[model samples]
Target chain A: MDILRLIIAGSVDNGKSTLMGRLLYDSKSVMQDQLEAMEKHSRSQAAGCPDLALLTDGLRAEREQGITIDVAYKYFSTTRRKFILADAPGHVQYTRNMVTGCSNSDLAVIMVDARHGLVEQTNRHTLIASMLGVPHLVVAINKMDLVDYAQERFEQITSEFSKLTQGYTFQTLTFIPMCALQGDNVVQPSTHMPWYQGPTLLRFLEQVEVRRHTNLSEARFPVQYVIRQQTSPDYRGYAGKIISGSYRKGDVVRVLPVGMESVISAVEVGGQKVEEACAPRSVVLRLADSVEVKRGDVIVKPDSLPTTTQELEVMLCWLDNKPLLSGNNYLLQLNSSVVQARVGQVAYRVNVTTLRQEPAPEHVAQNDVVKTTLHTDSPLPHDAYTCLRENGGAILIDKTNLATVGACMIQ
Target chain B: MGTHTLDYLEELESEAIHILREVAGQCERPALLFSGGKDSIVLVHLALKAFRPGTFPFPLLHIDTGHNFQETLDFRDQLVERIGERLIVRHVEDTIQAKALTEPSGRFASRNTLQIHTLLDAIQEFSLDACIGGARRDEEKARAKERVFSVRDAAGQWNPNLQRPELWSTYNGRVQKGQHVRVFPISNWTELDVWEYIQREGIEVPALYFAHEREVVEQQGQLMATSGLFPQGAAAAIRRRVRYRTIGDMTCTAAVPSEAATVAAVIQELLATRVSERGATRLDDQLSEAAMEDRKLKGYF
Candidate 1:
């Protein structure tokens, strides 16, 4: 069966949860007890009827405070496909949550309040989705019932969102006008908005192409473990998850930095012998002969291998409260390797709203997207994160506190 | 890739095997949390494929709730015996008896939350720095924000806001002296993938997973099984057809009416089904807005 992973985003009180709950409810994905609980919780709040958004706003503080704290996952299936919706919070403070929600997401289903059109939070979420490089987008103009489900109003919001999303790398942008509270354009075909002939949210979600690659080539295997047995003292193996490419017994592979070459004598993991292993696969390799490989060294094919370097240019989205300090050292982790790194230079910063690049800042604030250079203690095998993120991305940690403060993609 | 090779699922299996190897290699003392559930069973099979031809570098651990289904216990024992690996089983009731836990009462009572105590105790007992669980992100809303290598505080609590973002395959398993990491290799796999993988690999699962006739009753609009401990309410016993959406404490777990009698049929049912597995069956989550999160903070698995 086909499976799709999409991220749902909207401003505070824009019915993000309501839209999600509507989709789930209309799709018949909600169980009887859950529906009853939601109804009970909703009426107790004295808001007339229970909010369908309560289904996903599960954080007690979020429930009590009436705001989404972080991203919540919702699972449902249509007759044709299985859908995993990553519902992200809209508050600017929780932009990091939205980033985390959208990281591996295949599509972005952004919602706009029919009454308010596009607001600051809408721009923030849409920008965050674009910055995370989400491939597909659907701007659901919600609350159409309040606006009379008019085609003119729907077109107004769609153009506004489209005007802001002009220069980006999205595959397709769909606009569906509907009132989530009234069940229009969510699951069923909206009778009120006949001018809008596009598929409903469920139909659009079912049809969205969600092809993602794991980069199963070039064969980067960093040694996370070194194996030795008392029975076979001479036998040694390097174990790690494959970042890219395929590896098999008899294939000649190179161990990084030390530059030792060897043939794969055997490929064994969890006691089963396999002929080969590829990207995203975790396995152990036995060399044709003994090799001195440790936890930090990487093994890869001699050809199509990555460039090893001490310095890198990165597109970074700072995710911490303390901001960026150039003098401070942070531990950089990419794949199975970890090294000491420093922010060498903040080349420039970009304005998410205007899509304009400005001169380098002295330091970055929270939610600032910047281009910077980093220097590492050791050479890192690198690829452009946009091209092959599994091998090309890294997280910067506050060395003293061990807090992951920033995420960087190799440029 | 072999001819007639499985496409994405096989690739996913290979990826999981690689993660298993990394866990074994990177951590000094690593253990797999075997529940005898389909996910854990699949994990064991993947583990066997990960460290073949020698004794695995790690041991297998099961945090027994003592309220476990007898079939699951039997399957657990049989699998452990067949694998010939060291199996460490810790009991929650043992902790209750030790005064380490104050048991809950009423229909709301569950050792499900108590498994955390036994689990953390076992982790300390074995000095295991890495404990692998079969938790998938799709199971609930709170689990979605989880890191593949989730770090727990000394108190064994997960802070949703304090997670290290795992953008790529880069996983950080580092923690302080008393703190440990809970690694989930199958964090990305959905319910469908798990079922499809099980069916594809012909992996052995508990008999309860398939179609089985059992006395049940409708409680709170859910079909509660009538077992030794959990009383079947006065609802009629018309056994139309059914299967379990989730397997948990028999006292609270619910089942659904399904004609799916085989693995392939079950997969088809899952594909055609609109509601989530937990959505259809979980009674415990119906209690609070952040039920899963609260339980997780209290060290629920």
Candidate 2:
């Protein structure tokens, strides 16, 4: 079976956790012992029915506050396919957590309450999802039962969501009316809505194709480790997972940043020799000639090499409580390479909800996205985020505290 | 099929190898926690593939509870010898005598909890910057929230609230002095996936995992193997074919009634089993709702 990674994003009280619980419950993924434990805890709290949110709220503090604070991952599989769900918190302050969840996801499910149509939180999440390049979006209009399952309410929300998607880039967009509390159009078709003809949420998820999203036309391999034999001095290999494209045994490749050309003498995966290997496969390649190569070095096809430079223009999202000040030095880590870097200029801050640009901000606060430029101490090989995600995305860590403070996408 | 695609097992193997290589490249001083269990055995296999034709950058560290089954100890020694790697074993008995850690006394008394002190002491003694473990998120609730690279404070305590946001495949391996990170390579794998991989890779495990006719005694509705440290009483021991799903201290690990003598049969049984691997075999986890969480907070692997 194949695995589909997805993120659930929404505002507070939009029933994100409830929808997850219903999916697991309806699919029979919840085991007997886990259900019993939830039941026992519910009775102690005098809750008549088991709180579905308790299923995803694994932390004690989350249960106490009745809200999710961190990204909680859940796994379940049906006969058709398997799923890895990242449940992101909904509060405005936790936007960084949502970004963390969406970074690796192939799809995003945005929930909105039907009674209060479109809100700022919805706009913010949708924009972030687009910025992260999430290919698929499912705008689930939740709590339809509260609105008497009215067709007008669902259409109004969908039309409003359409207005927001006018400037965003999404490969696929879907809208579904759901009542997570009552299990309406979540796992099974809702009898109450005869006018709406669409697949249930579970059905859409099961049938969605998780195609390879990595760049396959240009071969890129970042050397993670060097394997050398002590007794036999002739044995040497460069081991890493291929980020994009394919490599064959006799292909000529160039070592990046140093620009040394070498021929691939052999390719091996799991200790067996293979003629060819492709993206996402961890393998070791033996070069015909001895060349100086180590970790943080990229090996790519000579014709499709990435740009190597010390100056970078990027769109960065501030992730730490400490404000990012211009001219402050930080560590820029991309792929396996780490180097000293400083923020050069703050171009503008983009208002995620209103889509307005504020020029010349003094400092970027937490959860704020800005367009900026950076100067690195050393030159590094990178691609535009619009071209290749693996080579374009990077994170900035504080030199003093070693905390990941910002996420940058090379523009 | 015209397009080349990897199966589920192959994909899982690739991911694990990537994680192991990341630890070797990033961490200054790293060690693999080997317990002679099936999961740890798989981890070792992946480490070998990650850097073959050369010795591992990190050594194997084992915390011996001294209540181990003889089969497990023998298996650990032979595997280390075959791989030609260094092994460091620290005994809980030594820590118990030095630190005056009280041992539980009763029919259900186990030295499992006491192993934490020895593990922490080993981490301090070796100055290991990263400890690679085989813990899976599907095992318990608290484990489900753990990051691929989980950080620990100077005092070896885990604060769930202060966990770093792990995005994409980028792991923040930066740590201060006297601090370390615990890396779980198989955090995304399920129990069934482990068994299937073990079978595919042809990895060797302790004999206790296979069904055998052994003398056993039923206590608190769990079957205890009479072969190891358990004291045999006057009551005649019952002989039944059983297999172990998890291997820990001999006193804490329980056996289930089964006829799975081979790896294929074990996979078949796993498909039909409803209870989780830890739920059926571990007595320590059944103590409370937050049993694993509490142990992890105090630096338990």
Q: Report the number of the highest-TM-score candidate.
A: 2
Candidate 1 wrongly placed segments (more than 4 Å)? A43-50, A61-69, A113-118, A143-167, A173-201, A208-211, A214-254, A257-303, A357-363, B1-15, B18-22, B53-55, B100-110, B190-192, B211-261, B265-291
Isolated chain A: TM-score per model?
A: 0.86, 0.94
DockQ of each: 0.35, 0.56
Each model's lDDT comes to: 0.76, 0.85
Instruction: Give candidate 2's error at residue B188 in angstroms.
Output: 0.9
TM-score of chain B of 1: 0.93
Across B78-149, the per-residue lDDT of candidate 2 in tens digits comes to 999999999999999999999999999766688998988998899999999999999998888888888888
Give the least accurate 10-residue stretch of model 2 chain B, judged by summed lDDT. Answer: B1-10
Q: What interface RMSD does each of the candidate structures achieve?
A: 3.9, 2.0
> How well does candidate 1 score on lDDT at residue A290?
69
Question: On a 0 to 100 scale, what is the lDDT of residue B205 in model 2?
Answer: 85
**Considering summed lDDT, which 10 consecutive residues are worst modelled in model 2 chain A?**
A61-70
TM-score of chain B of each: 0.93, 0.96
**Cα deviation in Å at residue B69, candidate 1?**
3.2
